[model samples]
Target: MKKSSLILASAGALLLMAGVYLAFFVAPDTVVRIDDRELVQFSQKIFYFHVPVAETSFVFLVLGGLFGAMFLGTRKRSYEQMSYAAVEVGFIFVLLVMITGVLWTRAAWNVWWEWEPRLTTFLVLTLMYSGYFVLRSSVQEESAKARFGAIFSIIAAVNVPLTFVAGRLDSLKPVHPKVFTLQGASMEGPMLAAFLVSMFGMLLFATSLYIMRLDLLRAREDIEYLKEELEVG
Candidate 1:
């Protein structure tokens, strides 16, 4: 690994551990009214990680779309590779978001699943990107694969706002928090600090993964080119 990448990965790991420690130990517990009784539920600890993961997924989603558009406009292999790598990273984060969200909901709502707007839209987006991979694999020609992948990624990016809006449309009775802004956040001091720390760590982690994956893909291309040249010689 490159020195910078290694440092980033290490820092991200440390921050993640520290954030976890703060969330479970130092952060104040949330007191909620349950049937007219105020109760402190330890399960609220999941919020520290869940929201950060979800937000990171959004960052990757935008990057993937932007790179996809660049690839389509320039018809460059490097841009296409970047776009694909971004989507791969986004997919991983989105999966984390879904899993963590499910865990949070199960703890808070006491059910495994619900057809809530946000949840449903997120699942659909996940499926769409899963199909994006399938579409790429089914194509025999590289140009066709890149073109289709770029278009699909752009379309998927357009859907991100819809997913977010769906979540907020039911704000009056939203199961999820309406806003995560720090200025007027419902999350108090220590809890908010823990969440911010985790978010920063997760973003760093995602960036490191994206860079590492892009380097690996470039190396693989170099190897493939060498083999072709040797064969021709």
Candidate 2:
């Protein structure tokens, strides 16, 4: 592993651990009243991790698209590698978002799934990105594969913002909880602090993964090139 990536990974892991500790122990539990009874929602603690992962996924996906645009403009293999790596890392976080979301939903809504606007839009986003890998593999030529993949990455990244705002759209009337608004975050001091720590941790962790994956892709390409040269010799 690269020194930079190693440092990022270690820092991210420590911050995430601290965030978890703060979320479970330092932050106050959400108390809701139902039928004259006060209930402490323990599952609400998942918010620190869930929201951070979801936002980190957005950041990576947007970076993938930006790198894709750069690759297209410059025709650089490095940018193409970066685009692919970011998307791969982003997709893993997307899956994590879905799994954590499902658990959150089950805890809050008493159901495994819901066809709410936010959830539905995110699911579509997931399916769209899944096709990115399929599109890459279907192409035979290397340049063509890269070009197509870049285009798909850009398109998929466009969906990220739409998915984010789906919950706020008046037409959608989404059931998903909204934590942030034009005013500010809906959470208190300690809760917000924990969430911020988790968010930064997740972003750093995702970036480290992207760098590692990009290095691996470059290594694989080098190996392939060496094999070709040896055969030619």
Candidate 3:
């Protein structure tokens, strides 16, 4: 990889570190609507980082799939490695998103795991993409593992949009109470700045995580190749 890409990866890691602090300490507090007649007070600040990170996770997930598809089309190992790294990082972000989302849902919606469209779809997406790893494990042959992993990665990518749309087909979409307003005093300047910082950090963290994984995978392949050569000699 170029020095610039390496710098970007390092920068992303630094951002993630900054994001964690901003998210926990700097955001505002507010009341969240749980149901038609119920409301619960929550830290208003988490919304900025939580919502943005969730969205960013999905974005990375899609990018992962795109790289996966590109790998298939070009039959280039680098693209394949990139796709694999993307999915690994995407998975980590998705898990974080799910955890934070569940906490928010429990406080706001009064349920641990609702069958709401987005939530449900995310669950499915998690399982399917995770299975991509399992599928790779089941194959013993080198070529077979790569081919299957690539194929499943593509399929999982295709399902993301489909699941997102399916998850939103419910009756209880976001109402007015949870919505932020400029005229109202919900989020002001300081809170917004903190929120933005947190978001940027999370995005940076995800990028760095992916870069690390990609390099690790490439190194593993190289080692495996050397081992085979040594054994043959």
Candidate whose lDDT is highest? 2
Among all candidates shown, the one with the greatest TM-score: 2
* TM-score versus the correct structure, for each prediction: 0.90, 0.91, 0.78
Candidate achieving higher TM-score, 1 or 3: 1
What TM-score does structure 2 among the candidates reach?
A: 0.91
Candidates sorted by TM-score, best first: 2, 1, 3
Tens-digit per-residue lDDT, 117-145, candidate 1? 76776788789889889999999997999
- Compute the lDDT of residue 62 as modeled in candidate 2: 90
- Give every collision pair in model 1: none
Q: What are the clashing pairs of model 3?
A: 27-45, 28-44, 28-45, 29-44, 30-44, 34-108, 117-167
Residues 131-191, candidate 3, lDDT per residue (tens digit)? 9888978999877777777788888888888888866665676532434333336556666
lDDT of 2 by residue, 1-233 (tens): 79999999999999999999999999888777779998988888888898889889888889999999999999999999999999999999888888998888788788899776656666877888889988999999999999999998998888667776765566745455543231345587998889899999988988899889999999999999999999998
lDDT comparison, 2 vs 3, better candidate: 2
Clashing pairs in 2: none
